[model samples]
Target: MNCKSLQPAAKKCVNEDCELHEKGFAKYFCNICNLFDDRPRPIFHCPYCNTCRMGLGLGIDFRHCMRCNACVSLADKDHRCIPQKLQGSCPICHDTLFNSTEPLKGLRCGHVMHLSCYNQYCRGQNYTCPLCMRCMEDMSDYFSLLDQAVRMQAMPAAYQNTICNIYCQDCEKTGECRYHFVGLKCTQCASYNTREMGRYEQLAAFPN
Candidate 1:
């Protein structure tokens, strides 16, 4: 059988372990495995991924997440797991996360994204997971403040009964809510950033 089309008219290896032995092509045959190639970086063959991945066992600051099927930073070893989370595009920038050379950051929600993209997203005053809409950090204190402000009716009565179209900074969803004496809550994520598209109206108090 002629195995000419496998690689080019290159040198052939007779070793049975060599991948090019049966194919009859050998460019840079490894004496051990006998396969064509000049690998530059430290390529670590992942048995799980069934492929060679660069930057392993070379003082690389990352750990392979078996659940995500990708390498995440060592700092994120304790991050939550979302099965096959890193297999697709990032939720923040919608860019492919796998095999990317950019710096990646794993969220508490088990999602990962480009570090720069995540920084820019948070710079826009959002502090929640873009995919799950869960608070990235514990904001129970802030929520308590909001709750207190509502109980005390700290907002001026002039703002009462106002109709506001709220866009949640956390969830990126929109809804309309009637203004109260304190804060307007988003119907979607219940976030208090209901400051968008506000319209004032004179809603009279209901008679008891």
Candidate 2:
């Protein structure tokens, strides 16, 4: 049924001998089915979702996203869209995200996770989206510090010219960089968020 046609149940019951009428339990009435309920006030039925949801009403606090097939906050109308983004489980907790009551946070990569989970994950020093392994926030300052640290450290005599293959999570590219125990910087983006593929080949040792 269209949500506009669904009316709030009546507050009082007309049945004289009904238990709800005697105890004043009937506080809402479903106009379509002629049923009374004591659930709560301000409940709304969403035609798009085809379910009764607790909120201020559709288009007031939230709106339905046809692409995601879920109701999202009105404030997030311009949020980045990922195909069926809300239809998956939280990456951290592995709990269902659709219709979940917990607050959610969206990442730059267009991934979503429970707000609490995001906080805990950040507190654990993880700054990338778990699903895509992409940097979730600007890491320019952090990467600059790594650059300074790498510059100050000198490689051992035997490995001075050593180079290694690395795949960068930030740039999503594979390249080679001078081998350093601190971290391998992406040759393309100069980001230290990279993993060594393996030691390439050793060359003539040279001073840094």
Tens-place lDDT digits, model 1, residues 1-208: 2433444334464455666566645324433333345545544544565544454531365566787777655655467878887678978768888756577777766778888988999899887777876667666578779877777764466665567667776567888776665666777766775456766574665211
After superposing candidate 1 on the true structure, give the runs of residues whose Cα lies further than 4 Å from its correct spot: 1-47, 50-62, 144-208
CA lDDT, every prediction? 0.64, 0.75
RMSD per model, one decimal: 9.1, 6.6
Could you tell me how far off, in angstroms, the CA of residue 147 lies in candidate 2 after the best superposition? 1.3
User: What TM-score would each prediction reach against the true structure?
Assistant: 0.49, 0.68
lDDT of 1 at 7: 43
Instruction: Output the lDDT of residue 175, model 1.
Output: 80
Q: Please, what are the lDDT tens digits per residue for candidate 2 over residues 1-208?
A: 2223333454444465555445653555445445455766565666776665556778898787787677767877446678788778999999998777677888877889999999999999998899999888778999899888888988786677788888998788998788988888887887788888888555565333
